[model samples]
Target: MPHDLNRLFPLRPARVHEVCGPSAMSFAAIASARAQGDFLWIREGWQPDTLNPVALSEMADPARLLIARTANQIESLAVAEEALRDGAIPLVVIEVTRPLDLREGRRLQLAAKNGQTTGLCLIPEGMGSNAAETRWHAAPLFDPGGADSTLMRWEIIKNKTGTLGFWDVRWNAAAHRLDVVSPAGE
Candidate 1:
């Protein structure tokens, strides 16, 4: 019986861990999930105008992405927890203003593992614990066009999967995709 259960439900790979810095971390996460398929996006204080409509449209077709906006952080987390329990979505990405504590994060992690889903918690700069598979610190990067423009660069601070760190990525808000950029001098 145990062998049958194991065969029916093989263990999943460890979720990717990453720490984002000062760039389009949210967009990057969304884009990545969209490419993979079957993911839910729980946005807190998300502004539609801030996202690139074309990019969002491309990846979110045919029910590839689901967006559920919440009134506050607690509501967002609660909704995420519920979704994880339902086991309907394969990935859940949440945007939060404050980092979750170790205990709460562990609970969420367990739920994700049990549900065979990936839980990505997006928080403000310096708003997460070591408990998360990957803790990302994201901020908007400078846009040569103008301060109001949406082009951004993101940095990856910590990656639990391996020693991968400090990635500078470019985001096209219009396309809602991430690209690797050359160094400043290059």
Candidate 2:
């Protein structure tokens, strides 16, 4: 079950989470679905058209989404930091092109801790150093079956614990949940 899967790697309330790789957006949607309440999405200059209201409506409630558009990564992070302070927003997703060093990363972590919000950074490959408690790599897999659900792969590249692994997850749109299709995709 999704609940059982979540227990293995639940998102910490006061921590920075990173979703990266070729298909970071897909992973962000999956992570967002697991969140409890409304969220704030901060889009850097790199992704202006990625925030489609119609598409978001399918994955999440468009009305509950609060968007902050910034000209640069610094500005986007600033907006995210402030939004993270609001405890009402359980999740804050930030899209950035560049990597974040430890110092700046610490600030984000602290803000999340103070507001008890979950911070998720959606970035592309070669992000260099990341201070997130957990780092994930997401990609889509070819599903010849053409199943109703989307078949995706998730790799826990880095985490607080020493646990490292990957899995094949199915995005069941009808149920609005992620199910473990295969462990390790072996």
Candidate 3:
């Protein structure tokens, strides 16, 4: 039987959570998912020397998680591709400093379709592209904790699968999870 993409995917309740930096929300989104047990993480060859040890430890624990780390962007993408092929990971998140062209985006989309995975590209703020199923522009929310705080508000710029609008989403840095706040019902 052919896989049912629609059944597996839903726009209404937005299963996929994303958090972008000033450049790409990939890291934030991945970090949040890692905290939530969506998929195992593998950081490729781009480990920063100044990474927070505490944060790293929390994200790497295998008992409450299935996250792993690689060494670079290429390796990370490869691992994600393999996971999709094996049906181990249904969602793959990638961060791109530069905006992807239609061809490249189409290729990634096709790959996701074939592997039955969702490819999420984190682009820089104000970076416009017509390739993704949805385009979101996110910004950090006000936090009393200080600059290191992870609270954020996601602005949904464009969503092809559902209504073209935005929603208020909060990321609890303590819980490392996202919660969508509902508007006041009529």
Best candidate per TM-score, number? 2
> Per-residue CA lDDT of candidate 3, range 29-110, in tens?
4343543335444454454532344554433333433444666555655665565455446555555545556665565555
Rank candidates, lDDT, best first.
Answer: 2, 1, 3
Full-model lDDT for every candidate: 0.56, 0.77, 0.48
lDDT of 3 at 180: 55
TM-score of 2: 0.88
Identify the superior model by TM-score, candidate 1 or candidate 3: 1
Models 1 onward score TM values of: 0.65, 0.88, 0.58
Model 1 regions more than 4 Å off: 1-22, 33-35, 44-55, 58-62, 138-152, 170-179
Determine which window of 10 residues in candidate 1 has minimal summed lDDT: 1-10
Give the distance in Å from residue 11's predicted Cα in candidate 2 to where it truly belongs: 1.9
Q: Candidate 1 at 121: error in angstroms?
A: 1.4
- Candidates 2 and 3 compared by TM-score, better number: 2
* Per-residue alpha-carbon lDDT of candidate 2 for residues 76-160, written as tens digits (9 for 90 to 100): 8888888887678999999877889888888999999999999989876768355788888888887766766477778888777
lDDT, model 3: 0.48
Candidate 2 — what's its lDDT?
0.77
185 Cα displacement, candidate 2 (Å): 7.8
Candidate 1 per-residue lDDT over residues 1-186, each given as its tens digit = 111212111112224233445443454444454445567777776545344545555435535667788888788878888876667776677766677777777777777767667676666666666767655455655656446444444444554543433333454545755455443553
